[model samples]
Target chain A: MKIREVTLSTTPNAEAVADLRLGDIIYLDGLIYTAREGVYMRALEQKANIPMELPSQSAANFHCSPAAVIREDGSFDLGAVTATASFRFAKWLPEWMAKTGARLIIGKGGMSSKDYNEYFVPNGAVYLSTVGYGTGALLGRGVETVEAVHWHEELGIAQAMWVIRARRMGPFIVASNLQGECLFERENAKISENLDRVYEGTKPAVLKRYGETDDRSDEVIG
Target chain B: MISLDLIQTTAETLMDKAAIEIPQDYLDGLRAAAATEDGDLSSFVLQAMLENYEAAKEDRRAMCGDTGVPRWFVKMGNDARVEGGFVALEAALRRATANATTGVPLRPNRVHPLWRTDHNNNVGIGAPEIEYGFEPEGEWMDLITVHKGGLFGTDYRMLFPSDGIEGIKRFYLDSLVAFGKRGLACQPAIIGIGLGGSKDTCMVLGKRASVLRTVGSRNSDPKIAAMEDEFKELGNSIGMGAMGFVGKNMVIDCNIEVGYCHTGGMQMSVHAFCLSSRRAVARIFPDGRVEHRTDPNWFTDYQRRETIEWDPAREAAE
Candidate 1:
């Protein structure tokens, strides 16, 4: 698999993301903004404001709710911040991407694999699936700082928008890429084919045990 | 009578432990999975999970940000006495969960679904749900806590009699495949299958199987054990890998729990728990002896112990 490094900035280099492919590995560094289902929906309705000045199709956004605590000393104690499923906001993602100018979407499970071509490819965006349970590792070494930007009270500590600085924050799989390829769909189809082959191989034996002839048309005849 | 303070403290400690410590069975299962991974991505992902466990434990942090809903399975003794009674016990648990929001520092997961209102402390009406089981003879109360991701990667379904065994198999495979396509999003899940009960009972059993049962433990009934074995192998064969990359093992294990149905229809449910199966059990005796148990054993007759050494350096070398 190909590997690429991404750095989120106000003027993100679009060329750096143009050659991204499905199943490639990405190590994201630099600045990132956090958002979840609420932020996207609220932003689309024009009710909420995105605090960061993100460049179109060059910014990396994490779909997460963080367990962050502000200490009495004024420093932030970052807790486990996990990915909310991408497809949960399926209908709004295309618009969110277009409006927010987010180029890289980091989440778990790929965004509705069925519509990757429609939602991601045209926008020069990609969906990367992070290691689901690696929250501790990410919070420990990846993230350097986190500051609440907007919706801190309404969205709680986790689902709120936060500006963060990260260092090698990810080694995510490119579930969907700019080339319109989707790793999640490809992998599922392969597994389904193998499962079908197993079912077919076991059908005759199961039928024989029930004292039924393996004529292959019992259900069809019925 | 058990003091209310004891109950509150126990609940707080248990939630904190559950959030920080990745259960031994979970770590063991992941180590075994890493050892057998056929693809580089799977191995890398599995190893990262192990490292996440160490990092959480060392840093005193929540293992997964989605510390999940606070679910308590309370086994109460028939003759046990409490200072505040059941009402007080429930209240204490609720307070304990909200308090742990900072101690275990659980993510504030409780929210008003429609308006997106934050409750801040994970406490709400019918929140921190307690499933009580009364034992006729016992002097101690056992509280088993499971922090399950309530929103993401949860599934339930009902089947008509016509659906039959073939239908059950199809449902199991179809869900796993769908979840797999989503990538280890919930990949390498410990699947809990509940067959032949009302929808609610089936969901309860499914949750118990996934969160309580030890990773490699089996159902005592021969049929269910065989079914578990078959599905475990079949799930791994799908090769959804560690994080849904192409690999040998999609599931760490499968646990199937069953109950007699009404003979009219079957309510089969599957609870998918991500590799981070976070849970902790605490037992409080009448004599004031408090013991913490890592093995949940919600269905099995006896508790079994499996010591797992999640050595990141060793795994990295492998």
Candidate 2:
């Protein structure tokens, strides 16, 4: 199958986001920013002023921390770029999208369809999952330069907000679309159809832990 | 005595190599998987990862940004000695870890668990865990560095003796399917299983089985080796490929490590070494001859010795 690929701006228009389909590959341009628990807690919870102008400067919020460092002379030596799992950040995402007008939520795993329907669709946002999940070097090649890093002193490099200029920085898969459909969930349903056959000879453990589910289709993430 | 300077410098080089270079054994396994993978999305992911490795090598950058938590495994020959005692050697390893964190421009991934303080050097209390193993003879020391991603793709369970191979199979499938969803565990990985040890040792054995052993290597016991082959085939049959898409390449290989446990209880652990499977090894002699290679050769006969004494002739005969 010839997978569709598209180039999009970090600050994309509604039409562009609406045009995205589940499983479509994306290459991003313009400005993008990295934020995870540190940026969200500081901005949404502690009420620290957000460093960059959100949505205006960039609508793409990447759940990432690049392998980068600042030299003694105060220049950046940025290397591979990749994303962390996004499911853990679900709590703060709704507030973050409302606060920053984020259009693209890019990360490791896409969130649930419930997440996309409840807030992402309403906010005109969608989820883009990093491909291979280990394609950091490839993604790094797309990064033009590190524009700036915020809150490194306070939150450390892993959690700090890193603003970067992306030339064609991606191979992200459209994991969620404007209609709140989830690509991962759709794929899971297909794979689950054969779980019974694969697990035919296996027997449950004699001792079971509390809160353990035997259901093969149940996802560990919320 | 091996030079302290050589140990430290070699460790630094190992860190860089582990981060930037994908091991040949793993590369070969992945290529084999890519060739057999028929799922479109899964095939695309495999191809992209292949290209990612080349990009990392050409650019001298880390294969993955997470870079996992960097740790050291030191295996020494009985006759080998360090320039300084083990304390000084540990200090040198710690220094190398910190220096490489900035020099290689690695993300300073370590931090205070509660306070969330960042040393920005990947060094902190109990950070860069240094584990040691010793061999029977030879005046050489081996340094192995593994940068494995910390989160997801690992689990432990307590089972009774009644929970036989069938039970083991059940838990294995559970771990693969659970973390395999959405590619959380990073499928097409080296799946390691630890059995028969105490809870803690079970985790350690499984972890080592995943990161220490090379792809296609098998357990010494023919029975366990057969199980490894069967597990590898079973994992691939799950119909889930990379990113949990419908595919046929969930596991690149399966490794099982076992230890003697209490007769009443059986402890099990599962671990996945993901696509980047970053590991590098070097053997340094007392004369300062250093040999670098991808295979760690960690689980030698001495390591898996079942007898009370080191009887090489007896082991060889057996």
Candidate 3:
């Protein structure tokens, strides 16, 4: 059997950001955003601008950080983590990316998991994590600038949004875009395929529903 | 067979101890989660837990500064007799709490629900809430706590899912969303999953579960444990790794809890405690003995409470 080969599109950031070839694994070393609960929901309801924030010490010590890592696994660089587990305003992720042009995302703690498959897959953004109490590391880095997160002033804590020049961030990749060159998609697709197959191969469940044998005698002749 | 008074006393001691420490099983749970990890996010979370565990024990530090609301589990000996029943038990516990606080000063984290007020001493009218369960074999108590000396964050998302086992994942997830929405950063994170029981109990269980899960121990329940692993895997997949450090892990621990299943009429009621998923546990036995559980997994941490010797006649020996 002869199998034809196909090639994907290329981008200038590909080599610099180690961006995946829409299918190849690549390590990313660049700036990313952080967002969590309050900021997200408010944005969804009020359509307010907000920035992503990393987990604070309390959340870090208690909850896992919302980030992921990416590395090449053969020809593809699949994401290990996805969007933050605590999804806030994930619906606007595409819009956020459209505005920022930041191809990579760094949150996956609170958002509903399926958001990736639904919205993120269609968008160019890739999600991942650095979960588990990395509050100090997130904050200690030198900041370059920040965006709309400032609106929530009364809400004080460590897990806030800001963009900064990370000194030497590395081996970054977790859940990521499965739709294009991202590795998360492929892995997820593969798993889903296998699961589907298994589900198909299994026999039907033996139990009949409770109402299947309802007595016709009770029904009116009509 | 231990006496019922001994059991009640154990519960008293448990509450006092809980007010001051985090357990090791929780640390191990976070670490074990790294297996499903795919990047720096997962690794960083594991590392933070390890460091936190070290800091809490070696430096006598609290695992989490929040040191949340306090709760206890009293497993009484059915055959055993209480000198004066719950009244005596509660009185002794109150004394123990006061005595322990005078020196240990467990964080005063309880607040009046309606008034939104605080007592600051970690001791209020109903602080260190306790639950009584009579086990046929012997008397023992598991005092669990999360109380802080002062109220910290006041945001709604800051402490959602504060009630029960009803929808814990949603609560924790909501908290995560709030953190992002509020733009709080450098979050010293600790994850807790309160399962089983009604609202209040479930939340308390959540805090306890968080601190109790070892750095890398899986939940024994295959279904729930698998979910925990899946959560870590999915979280790591996102690359919210290492303090959202672009390569750090999104989570370190996914603490869990399992409550008693509802049995009969009025099935509407369910109770549980929060799993304050974090690292470090300081297990102090009845005879003033201290044993720390660092890992998040339930059984390990190289610790067991030493038996407290009881003189049959010397009740006043101190």
Candidate 4:
């Protein structure tokens, strides 16, 4: 399908997401949150029930803003900013999902199949990753500072939330999703096959020197 | 002698906010893409560019590497003359260039090709690569200097001549496939390409063209943009999928640069970099005036190529 960019200028959040596919590049502009990984993990350690008003659904997006997504007009209503990373909360996500109704996790990649299966469907959350090291490109999208970052003073850069304006925030693929349809598997199948081929063809001399006979050949060719 | 403070502070400020003035067309193509594009990676990549802007503002760091190698595009007025010395004025400008290197910790970029030794990354040896043009009629001289970033080191790759392929897109797709086959995507990187020059220069121009782009800039020519559009479509159609996972699309954006080429015998090549295509560009004015075009109309909405001929069923019915 055409890469989708829907302007989710809904009630509590005015965010946009790319109608994501297996592959597409996205740049987000407009408001988002920054969930420092260290601070969030600490929250989990304390068994803290940090609160929010607009807790997300499996379909909603997680943004990197300093402020919680709030009523467009500003009231008690708020939205759950996606955690910075999903696996960063591997231990915490299952419990967090049961309570919060948060669906989206946006950051860099890497999540296990088990994580994708459990909390994702039960809690209706999807894990998304932002572009890696494209900080400069992301900055060009512009930032709207809504809330000054707030956290326990000692928390330092961790745990503080600053609502921001994200530009082109998505079109991010959930390499792993509640549904078995994973972006990671489809993308890497060809690669894995090719690697197996190379390994199987490894030279006998090279394998002897490295003490690395091909395991792939024994499994497949045999 | 030019005062020490003047040299230090002026070049410092100029280096920062240097890429800000790039035409919106460039940024509009790649950066502004945030506003459009449906693919997840496309939006995310666009977001990363947006962050570049934010960091520049918060830290007040140059948007992308001191607006790249600072050199003035000068048009001197007939009446304009130095009061004390021409060489001294140029020398003072040179000194300011010296201070910029330390202040920015800019990569030691420039080196002689023949001698192959390091030059202080100075605007020396015509290093800033100055070009002078006097208006045939006008009195006022216009000087614009751009600081091009030096994103050199190991990221260089070459595009093969088309081998009778249709256009640049095939070359780009081939590069992405090769990179995937090599496991380069395990790290974050973008493929940068330059086409139409000689084997070496064409590749160099590709990398350099990326610098011309603001953190998220795109090619200006409509034809090039169309090719980019086609590139994305072909990529997605092939099912490489995001992260090579689901769809045919593997690349976030296949940025390509081209010089004029023959209609019958177009030369195309590839340069793929793993995830971090760290790039930046800048400009400087001889009179200390500078600006960059921040946006441009670069890529168009993803368009499936229009079917040229009527379908067999439709033809039969007609």
Best prediction by TM-score: 2
Model 4: what TM-score?
0.41
Worst 10 residues of 1 chain B by lDDT: B300-309
TM-score of each: 0.86, 0.99, 0.41, 0.41
Pairs that collide, model 1: A65-A158, A66-A158, A80-B65, B184-B187, B184-B243
Per-residue alpha-carbon lDDT of candidate 3 for residues B132-226, written as tens digits (9 for 90 to 100): 54433433333333332122111111122222222333334334322322112223234445544555555555555544444456655567778
Point out the higher-scoring one by lDDT: 1 or 2.
Answer: 2
**Candidate 2 lDDT, A96-164, residue by residue in tens:** 999999999999989999999999999999999999977989999999988999998889888989999
State which candidate, 1 or 2, has the greater TM-score. 2
DockQ of each: 0.32, 0.88, 0.05, 0.08
**Index of the highest-lDDT prediction:** 2
Candidates 1 and 3 compared by lDDT, better number: 1
| Consecutive 10-residue window with the lowest summed lDDT within model 3 chain A | A57-66
Task: List, in order, the clash count of every candidate structure.
Answer: 5, 0, 229, 125
Model 2 C-alpha lDDT per residue in residues B1-318, reported as the tens digit of each score:
999999999999999999999999999999999999999888989999999999999999998988889999999999999998899999999999999998887878898999989899899999999999999888999999999998989999998889899999999999999999999998789999999889999999999999999999999999999999999999999999999888999898999999999999989999999999999999999899999999999999999988888899999788
List, residue by residue over B51-166, the lDDT tens digit for candidate 4.
55555456544343223356644444445444344555456556655555444434234545564344444454677654454432323333344554333212232323333334
lDDT (Cα, 0-100) at A32 in candidate 2? 91
**TM per candidate, chain B:** 0.90, 0.99, 0.56, 0.49
Chain A TM-score across all models, in listed order: 0.78, 0.99, 0.43, 0.61
Instruction: State the displacement of the C-alpha of residue B197, model 3, in Å, after optimal TM-score superposition.
Output: 7.0
